[model samples]
Target: MSIHRLIVKSAALLTAGIAIGALLAGAAAAQQKLSFLAAEYSAKTLPFWEQVVADFEAANPDIDVTLEVVGWNTIHDLTAQRIAAGTMPDLVNTATIWVPEWVDAAAIRPLGDDLVDATLRADFVPALFDKGAVYNGENWGLPIAAAARAILLNKGLLAQAGFDPDAPIATWDDYRSIIVGVKEKTGAFGYAFDAKGVRAFRDFGYYLLNNGGTFFAADGRAAFNSPEGVEALQFLVDLVKAGAVPDPLGTTLEDYQPMYEAGRVATMINGNFAIAGIKANAPGLEIAVAAVPVKTAGQTPVTWGVTDTLVIGKAAPVEASRKFIAHIFSTAVRNQFDEAEGMLPVLLSQAGNPAFTGDPNIKAFIDMLPTSQFDPFHPQYAQMQELVKTAMQSAITGAASPKDALDKAAADFNALVK
Candidate 1:
């Protein structure tokens, strides 16, 4: 073998090695595709999600993303079916209320410091990230929007009832008086309550929180059976007994909409989403939105301000999903998505963006983020809501005392958590 023969062999081997490496890299890139099943965006024209995907793909050409928007009503069924089949999407815009249960079911993975750096954590509203996304002390997802339930009161009714339209309702006693006054002056139900079903839990939840109580105690025991809980339920029962609020054993807000529209309901409690609906139902109706009245004076305002969260499934490629999470949450994309969805921006700096500032109703909800508390993130949350409803109805219908009804609910809650 001469020097020329050796040199030709070495060059041929090097060229083959380079070509093989390129082929491997292209194959790896092709395999880096992510499937995201989301709700709400799947049907929108010019969806903000599509824009986010396009921007992400532009910045990251090597990764492919598939977005499937499922309808809000059907997404839960789809998620359950997919999870049962072990075919959950790589990323899912999880039903915020169910994220904890998903974590418990081993459907999603808990994100760690490696995947969520300080900068990424800091990008979201601190309280939202801290309250809405954490489950059992672990950060399990990211909240994309923030909204809270507030009180919508008709100023005209307040004035007619000899109450100052500008004065905010602060205590249960005062709220009761207003309810009575409205009934006396206008002969209309002062409060339109949705107390007939599971949603009844939320209507009473206002009283529970304002009284400085929680569903579960620090020891992980069901504690709403305590005095605070009794006070809350007793108040509702008293209202129904006094005929200030009609029997609300199985009704929901939609049922009360007609009453609200007819000017027969003085105050209704609901979330930011209700503003547009109320306007559409009665375009001439004038109302004021404020933090729900507290159980007592001098208590800090509190309401369940929820955020829509996206979580990565356990079967998803963690690295790719993480990169997508980071990309989708970039300030530009986040602000735009929130604006289009009529949601508050997750970032603190965007608090004053005219996009959010222009809507006073949304602003009231946004200003509440600081004082809001996310509902308990537990697998038993739905059951808990039902149990609370049963207890409330039993008390309101005179089937049991407040303490007795709540005691039974505590037993049920304890059994579920057990």
Candidate 2:
């Protein structure tokens, strides 16, 4: 070869070698490191989570995932705080109510409309994916677990009241009569609610919806303080006055747990988590779960349905994070993870799978899903909770009429949004 040709060939070889080395280095650098934040209950189901995570990592050997266990009470605040501090995990599990807030803050990254598969999205119930995941016209998170406010009754207690425990409690009037009969005959309070805790507000939300009242308007204005809301609040107050529930002045969610376990309360209107707690505390007791009864005949039954979503943090690598999220919702993982935690699975396929259907009691949550009321997809959710909490405490404590209290709460909530 001529000297010039030799020189040109040598240079080309050097350039190709450099390009190959750079490609290898870039590939290595693309290996992702991710962490997920979840509650202790889910942490206890770590083995199931591990199987799911291991499958994902095995499929994508370049990724490493770490699970961080968060305490339930602080997870919401912790998620927001870390995101605000610019130290958010790659993925975090949070309540549905937090989705809109995080989306507004730009703390959560969307799946990008192009990446969301139409078939997969269609597999999700429209009402759920639309109302539960979408906020301000954006999808913020994917649901993993579902929760709903339902009535948990002691089957033995109802039988003692001369009613079949397996029979559905269809109306508030029927439930009330049974409660009074149980109270009169057995000398036990027939119902128990978190009369003093933030949960007190949830009952009003559930019952108001049960009575055909909307909790919030499409514009996010308070709509629950209407006649239905007032009537629901009065019913709760009456339960307290009639000695069906413990003193409204001195009851918390924690208080009701033990009371129900000890058989002091014949029925409880609480979240699905109560199932696990009840089983742990009173293993031998016969218990049944039912949807919140309708307020009057011909009214469609409704309940407070809640969910926790897994959101990819804005700081996460988009493509890899999306894959991990998709894996988490895979049929095998969602079925095992949700049932292990005593929660409803978000995947439509697993929603009523035989594995979850073993317990007939849990059917109430599944049955109510079509009509359940979701918390408003408001960006000001945390603030709205505060407003509702204050009004609820005031009404439950008898410091203000339910109408005045809820009306003021609505005003305050609207003001915060404005």
Candidate 3:
């Protein structure tokens, strides 16, 4: 071979080697590590979350995801600790109300337009997707499941107590009367009150709202000790004192699930997402969705709505995180998750379907959306929740009189609300 031809051949080989090395490097760089820290989901819907994680990782071999589910009761405190230590997860599944506090601390990033695409966004129920997730004009989270509070009544229990199974429970007086009657005749706890853990405040808030009370007054200070607030707390204490409810100081709804399954709990305050659980665990038990009993006669029946969201930290790998989120919210994925979770699908394409509208219990929850108000937004929402939780637990446990507990909660709230 000629010397010139040999030299050219060596140069070509060198170039090819360099090109191969560069391609390998690029492939490695494309691989992303994304961590998702989510609060614990219900038994029925938890597997779906695991499935989504597996599916996303499978479809995108270039990306890796770490899924960690934390106990709901400790998520708030744990998330704060993680963020303070600069170890906040790339993505977090959190309750909707947490957004304001997260935003105030600059912990969460605004989702890019692709993740919050117009077409996909347009599919959600307007009030939920459009209003709930939007903060300061840009979207911050992907709403996953929407739930409305309701009174879960075991209809068979009502019949045995001589109450009309078909009658809608209206006033709180009637609610308590039924509770006492159920206790007297059946020797079972008439109510299962979750006065412990993160659920305490929201569970007790039903009474606060029914009594026409507000959490914060006009100037954004704690006003929950109003006559209505006092009334709400008193009822909680009364139920415990009257032995109409199980001791609720240190327990959650989960602790009473077996009771409900055994038909020992006549009624409880829970979200509509519990309907499927009731049917699945205690089959053939007649059930009804009653209006959350109100305090005043002739008052409008009302309930609160809560939405959970998928949040991305500001320091996250935005591109990859956005892709994973968009994938899970695709029409098929969101619908399946919502159905299994017993929550209202945020998307109209799913929520508007007859599948949700046709069921009377589901329909009752849906109808509440129009009047379902999220608690007023505040930067100290997490702290406020804790304060209110303490008041509920203390009152129900008889550690403090209802007035003392509520008044203290109001005072503690003032320190933060300012």
Per-model TM against the reference: 0.83, 0.86, 0.87
Better of 1 and 3 by TM-score: 3
Off by over 4 Å in 1: 1-31, 41-64, 71-74, 113-118
Cα lDDT tens digits for candidate 2, 1-418: 9999999999999999999999988987888888888765644565766777888999999887887777778888888788778888888878888787788778888866444566666666566676777776777777767777788889888888787777788888888887888899888788876645656667667678889887678777778788998888888877777877787557887887788889888988877766876888799888888778889889988778887777778888767776787687677777777667788767677755875677766776677677777776767766666676677778877899888988898888888776
Q: Using lDDT as the measure, name the better of candidate 2 and candidate 3.
A: 3
Give residue 206's error in model 1 in angstroms: 0.8
Lowest lDDT 10-residue stretch of candidate 1: 39-48
Sort all candidates by lDDT, best to worst.
3, 1, 2
Instruction: Identify the leading candidate in terms of TM-score.
Output: 3
lDDT score, candidate 3, position 154: 80
| lDDT (Cα, tens digit) per residue for candidate 1, span 1-418 | 9999999999999999999999998788676889998778323424777878888888887788998887766777798888899898988886688897788779988877656677888867778787776877787888866668888888788888888766777788888999989998889889978777546888878888888878888766788888999998888888888888766975677688678877889888877756666777788877787677778788777877767788888878867787898887877777777665656688776766887788767777777777888877667777878888889888987899999999999997888786
Task: Give lDDT for model 2.
Answer: 0.77
lDDT at position 403, candidate 2: 88
Question: Ranking under TM-score, best-scoring first?
Answer: 3, 2, 1
Q: In model 2, where is the ten-residue run with the lowest total lDDT?
A: 111-120
Residue pairs that clash (backbone atoms under 3 angstroms), model 3: 124-347
